[model samples]
Target: MTAKEIFDSTIKEIEPLYGNDEARSIAFSLLEHIGIMKTAVLAHQPMETDTSILQKWIERLKKYEPLQYILGETSFYKRTFRVNSSVLIPRPETEELMEWIIRDFGSVEEDFSEKPAVTIMDIGTGSACIAVTLAKEIAESEVFAMDISEEALKIAKENALRNNANISFLKQDILHDFIFQTPLDIVVSNPPYVTENEKSAMQANVLNYEPHLALFVPNEKPQLFYQRIATFAKKYLKPTGVCYLELNANLAHQTAELFDKEGFTEIIIKKDLSGNNRMLRAAL
Candidate 1:
């Protein structure tokens, strides 16, 4: 078959399962991967040829594999980063988190007298998206990251190298580690905030395909990671340092309360494009 035929066939087969737009996205991505641009694929004549690439992706999609993982890369903040089952696919909302950090820290770079190096630590830094993005944008900030999952850390480290981002990756269980090598200028995290009770509400693609360690927290203690990370930030963050979080909408108020109780003054909760409570930033 020609590339156009293959793309159409793939889209038809997967549309029933993933809907029209996502199916089209999957088809176009596969065609692109095989060196067939949309224009070229459309114009090419039909031919008797193998269609294994489309079939393989369809099979994976049937099992609920995320397209980003199937494609092996995803766009975030105008840059591409490798993604897989080992790490959560970077999302546009997370890009907003990076933008927020840059807006807050980029101004600090303007000081020329005894310019202090800002240190940033990303807790549960899956795929190192935030850390690498910050390091790339801020230029002089010292970025460090930690994750308990070895598989996730591996992918994160690879992404850091691929992006040429100077971030120090350490395999640490944040629940256990409370001290930092040095005081941090900011502590940011996009931790697992999806509570067990909310899993049934997640889309099938996310529920079945995304890594649970990076997506969920126990229902019994939904805000456990946030509490731990905030308390740690209190201990480790510089007096003027800030803590930023990409939070669960359901618990935005509670998450802010947690920070307030922890004595993080000047807490601010911000919503995503969807207008659900999505992120929190606070200063010590």
Candidate 2:
């Protein structure tokens, strides 16, 4: 079959599942992954077509499986991080959090302090995207990432090595262990913020494919993770240290309130590109 024929048929096949924008994104990604550029596929009659793979791809999309899982990697902070069902696929909003950290800390090379190393810990660090990225960017950063899921910690460790980011991977539950003898310069997290009641508000691709443990909290306690992390930050973080978190847009105020009760000062809410209050920053 011709490449254009394959392209058109693929779009026609998946457009009903996702709208034109997402369908075309999936189509173009598949084309690029298979080494057939859009113009080449359009110009040439045949561009080394693979029927079986194409059929399987279409079937998966029909089930609303995230393309990141299908592709086994996603772009984050101008770098690629491998992803799977074991970890939540890193999202663009998470990138904004990373950017905020990078901006706030500034580069170590730019700092003239003789003691330049900054200690950072990412709680519930799924995929280690934040830990790894900070390690790579901050230059003089000593980073640690923690996750309860052994599978997720495995992937996070792999990503740290994949990016050559040199972050320490610890398999620990943040909810259990609150000990930090050495105070942290920064603590960041994007822990489970979605409440059980909000499940209906999420897309099928997210609700079905993403790991529930990484995405949700009980209905009665919508801010459980934030509460725990914020309270921990009060004890573990340095007097001048800061914490950054990704917040559920619906509960930004509540998350900030949690920080305030923990005696965290300068509690502020920041919005993503969509203008939704999606991040919170606090200091002790």
Candidate 3:
């Protein structure tokens, strides 16, 4: 069959669940995964490929499974990272959080050899996207990533190795008390901020396919992770260090207040491309 035929058929099968625009996007991505480019598909090029694998993907999509999980990978900050049911898929908003940190610390002209190594820790580091990206993008950065799930940490380690980013992996539950041997220059996290009440508003693709432990908190304590992060920042972050977090837009102000109560004098809430208050920067 032709690439266009496969693309159109896949879209038709899943359009009801994802809508036309999203279905088209997903179809294009699936085709690209099989070495079929969008241009070739659109140009009506005939392609020879395995049909059974494509059929399996279509079946998963019909069940509201995420395409990233089906493909076993996704692109984050221009780098590919492996993902599965064990980890939450990295979102674009998280990229903005990485950018904010990079903008503050990254320099192309400066000699990193003359400066001390920038110490960074990523809490609840699912696929290690944030940790690995920071280690690769910033020169002379020593990175550490922690996650509660053993499976998630395994995937995170593979991503770190694949990207050739040096990171120390820790299996930790941030809700519990923990200690670090050295002071940190930066602490960053995109921890579980979505409350149980918000689950109804999310799409099936996310709710069904992604790891719930990394995506939600009790509705009564929506700021649970934020509170712990603020407390950890107070204890571990250096006097000149900063903390970066990806916020739940609906509770941005409330989350910021946690940092303020922790005596973080400087707090900045930055909006994502959608103009939602989605990123926070706090400093001691």
Give the alpha carbon lDDT tens digit for every residue of 112-193 in model 3.
8888999999999999999999998888999999999999999999999999988999998999997788799999999898
Q: Please report, as a residue range, the 10-residue window in candidate 2 with the lowest summed lDDT.
A: 107-116
Model 1 residue 118 CA deviation (Å) reads 1.7
Off by over 4 Å in 3: 108-110
RMSD of each: 2.1, 1.6, 1.5
Checking candidate 3 for backbone clashes, the offending pairs are none
Regarding lDDT, does 2 or 3 come out ahead? 3
Worst 10 residues of 1 by lDDT: 107-116
Q: Is candidate 1 or candidate 3 better by lDDT?
A: 3
Candidates sorted by lDDT, descending order? 3, 2, 1
- Model 2 per-residue lDDT at 122: 97
Best-fitting candidate, measured by lDDT?
A: 3
lDDT tens per residue, model 1, 10-112? 8888899889998887788887876677886678656455667757877888888888888889988877899888788888888888888888878435653
lDDT of 1 at 96: 85
Clashes of each: 0, 0, 0
Predictions in order: lDDT: 0.86, 0.87, 0.91
lDDT of 2 by residue, 1-284 (tens): 67777778889999998999989889988877776688876685676656678678789989999999988899998889999999999989999988898888876567636666899999999999999889988858899888999999988988988888888777878777556676899999999989898998899989999899999999999988888898778878888999999999999998888888888899889999999999999999
Q: Cα lDDT for residue 47, model 1? A: 49
